[model samples]
Each structure stands twice: as structure tokens, then as C-alpha cells.
Target: MAFDSLGRFGVWRGYTGFSPEEAREYEQLGYGTLWLGGSPPADLPGVESLLAATETITVATSIVNIWVAPAKEVAASFHRIEAGFPGRFLLGIGAGHPEHTGEYRKPYDALVEYLDELDAAGVPAERRAVAALGPRVLKLAADRSAGALPYFVPSAHTAKARTLMGSNALLATENKVVLTDDTNTARTVADPAIQLYLGLTNYVSNLRRFGFTDADLAIPPSDRLFDAVVAHGTPEQVVARLTEHVDAGADHVAVQVLGDDYLPALRTLAPLLAARS
Candidate 1:
């Protein structure tokens, strides 16, 4: 997998909230890729919109949930996007949370089946990625897709993922960021943002692997857990934390800035990311 196409870092945000204008600005700011977070549908016109808005930036789904969107449909969407944009789109697929997905069965098996369908539908393995955390799924990502796209994890998890997937595969991890120097304010802003993941077993399990105790994963995440997951501080501080993933062998880091307004933070961190590149 050629991660150079994705550059060293990218912006990860929800598809619904952002505009084409903002995406173009990110491209101008020198970010390599733009990932649309959340479980997007199979017909990813949003991918088309972003690609049309930008010139060279790669646009990918942070994850398109397999339980909700069928693989054949997703593959068709992939082909449609590829035809129009060529090498600019990546199909990121996952078997989302069991609690949230009504039809969620054995996620690993379902993911394999979905990959099989993508293969049958002519979506090449290199053009797609899997959102994985555990060793089993991470190995599967290495074997089946381009690599693993692990979310809600710390730098330690990135190191473990790189070790599991080896050097050839892509290990793109998403790190949450809040541009603030005050610890209390940063935690307060991050608390609600992270509350949703606390109920999900998959994320909780991954956090435990990072040595987070039950107290840390409580309703309002403990400072230890929040600090570890969210890179909260100045632009330089956030860049330092993001670099931890790169040093740990991550191929790319998709930064998800916390809070409603993302432009100010993106503007603040753009130069820092570009400098690291």
C-alpha cells in the first residue's frame, strides 16, 4: 500500500457537518487526505463532492458500516467514485458496534464476507481498508485489505497495530484533538464527545488494552483516559502527540478536532502538520 498518496496526516470529520468550501480550504492548507467519519451509506456522493471540491487531496470514508450498507452496493459506489475521480477515493469498511448494529453477528466473519463481496464486485483490496482494533481483525485487515484504520485508540495501540500488520500494510489511526492549553477546559470539552464510545464494548475493550481501568472508562471519562485519547493543548502540543503515532509506526494519522467549530483548530494545526511532513 502506498501511503504516500495519503500523505503523513489528514482531517477526519463527519460528512454531514462540513462543506465543500471547508474541504477545499483543507486542501489548500496542505493536509493530504480528508476522511468522512461516521457510518456513511453505500452511495457515497459525499466522496464525490469532496473530490470535486479539491484538486489533489485524497478523500476516504473513515468507515462505511457493513451491517447497514451491503458490500455489493458499496462496491458499486466505489466504482462510480473511481470512474469520476480515479485514484482519489478509498473505501473504508467496518462491522460497526454490536450494540448499535441490529444485524451485527460475528463481525470478523461478516467483514470477511463483505470483503469477498467487494472482491467479487471488483473493488480491489488495495483501494479499501478495515476499521480494526483486535489482533484477529488487524491481521485480517493486513491480509484482506490495504490496512487497518483503528479509531478511539492511543499511540500504544498504534504501535501494537503496526506490529500486528507488519511494515508493508497501512496503519492509519484517528486521534482526537482539542486546541486548548487548559487541562480542565480541554477535558470538559472532550467529556461529552467521548461519552458515546464509553457505552460501546469494542472501544471499551480497546481502551482496556491501553491499561485503562473501569474507573477511567466511567460516564465522564477520567482525566487519564481523556488525556491519553485526546491530544488537548496548543498546536505544538497536539502536533507532538500526533507525532507519537508516526514514531510508533503509523503510516498516516487522521486528526478529528473536537468541538463544533473545526476550522480554527485546523488553521492552527495545518502549519505544524506540514512542518512535520
Candidate 2:
């Protein structure tokens, strides 16, 4: 029942980019939570600002990277947010990519150690989640935190994750969407983001697990892989794909509207997604 607080859908954006004004608009559009990505600062004043701007929409970190944001500082910040905003903040933490972390070694062990720190610092397990992609970390997320917030994944991944995490834990999947009917246009708009993840070992490994080959991960990703990872087309068609995620066992879908402008797409899908949820 704790997962119910997240509603059926949320809006995902980079923490440094989205304004507090836009956060209010997301809540108005019926999204239940706002996920701040890009490993926000440990203090999380941006999360606080968004919470202060809105009334009830939950604010979650898509992740605060363990390497960048220390556990004690993040815990103190979580307590600060909880005091002011109460149950509106959900802490999502992760090991981040080895490519990005200079000290990255034994990520699983590091994540376990980070969780131990959070636990000692009094960050309740129910109030946090892990940015888990693989089976081992997914199970760890279920055992330690509230659940899993898996990013850049498809419904098949969601279905597999749900099987690993079981019924009690939260399964909030992050799905990217492009608002256009033309396949070529959609792929062009999404390719930059897709290309970025293609280089990341964690994302690449997860996609490989789901049957994506090295050819699919090449510079210009294959349409099959692109379509599998990103939902595109009319609002209705995109909503249909989003519904597939929900049907596949996601408790909540954090929609990342790709492209320069997020509002127009988010605005268009609000009512259509509302109807489905």
C-alpha cells in the first residue's frame, strides 16, 4: 500500500533543469510524483524547493549517486525534507556507472555499505528505493529499501524485475517517450539520449540480458532496440505502450518526455494517460 502514494505515473527530469513552476504543472497534469535525476546534491535543496512549490506531489530522486552524495549528508537532508514535507519525499540512491565513478569498485558491496550508512543515519527503509537494473541489485533493493526504480527499461524488463522483487516491494519503472508519429523523427530525437546509454556498461548489460545484441547497441541503435526502450507516436499510441508497462507489473511508470520541450508532450498525454490509469 505504500507504493499507492506514487499514483500510476510520475514525471522524470534532470534535477538541475526543471523549474519549480514546471513541477506544479506536472502535479496539475495528474502526475503523482516528480523524480529528479542526475544525482542531485546531497543537501537536496532542489527537492525541497519543488516540494515547497507544490501541495501534495511526491518528490523522489531518480538517484543521488553514492559516489557523489555521501550517505550521512543525504540522510540528514532526507530528514530535513521529511520534517518539512513529511511523507512527500522518497530517497532513491544508486552506485552509478563505473565509467563515471573514479573510485568505482565492487559496486554491489559499496551499495550495501551505503544502505548500512543510511540505516544507521535513520533513513527508514520504507522511505527509500534503489536504482536497480540487474537481478542481484533488484533483490537487494526489495530486501533493503522500499523497492526498485529501474531506468531506461522496457515492459519486459519490468516484468522480469517484478518477478525478482516479488509482490510486496515497489516496482517503479522509468520509460522514455517521444511525442511523434514518424518513426524516423522519433528515433532521431531519441538517439542522442539512446547513444549516451549505449556506452554505459550497466545499461548495456541489462539490455543484453533482455536479448539486445552488440549490433543493436552500435552508434545509431537499431529501430527494434530503440522502440523497445523508448515509446513513441501519438499520445494515444504512446499511452498504449505505457499501459503495457503497467500491465507487465510496474506499480508506477515515471515518464521521461524526451526532446527539447517536455511540456507539450506531457500536456498532450496527461488526459490520455489519466484515462488508462
* TM-scores vs. true structure, each candidate: 0.98, 0.98
Determine the C-alpha RMSD for candidate 2 after optimal superposition of all C-alphas. Answer: 0.9
Query: How far is each candidate from the true structure, as Cα RMSD in Å?
Result: 0.9, 0.9
* Candidate 2 Cα misplacement greater than 4 A, ranges: none
- How many collisions between residues are there in candidate 1? 0
Candidate 2: pairs in clash? none
**What is the model-wide C-alpha lDDT for candidate 2?**
0.92
| Candidate 1 residue pairs in clash (backbone atoms < 3 Å) | none
Q: Write the per-residue lDDT of candidate 1 for residues 92-155, one digit (tens) a residue.
A: 9998999997877999999999999999999989999999999999999999999999999989
TM-score, candidate number 1: 0.98
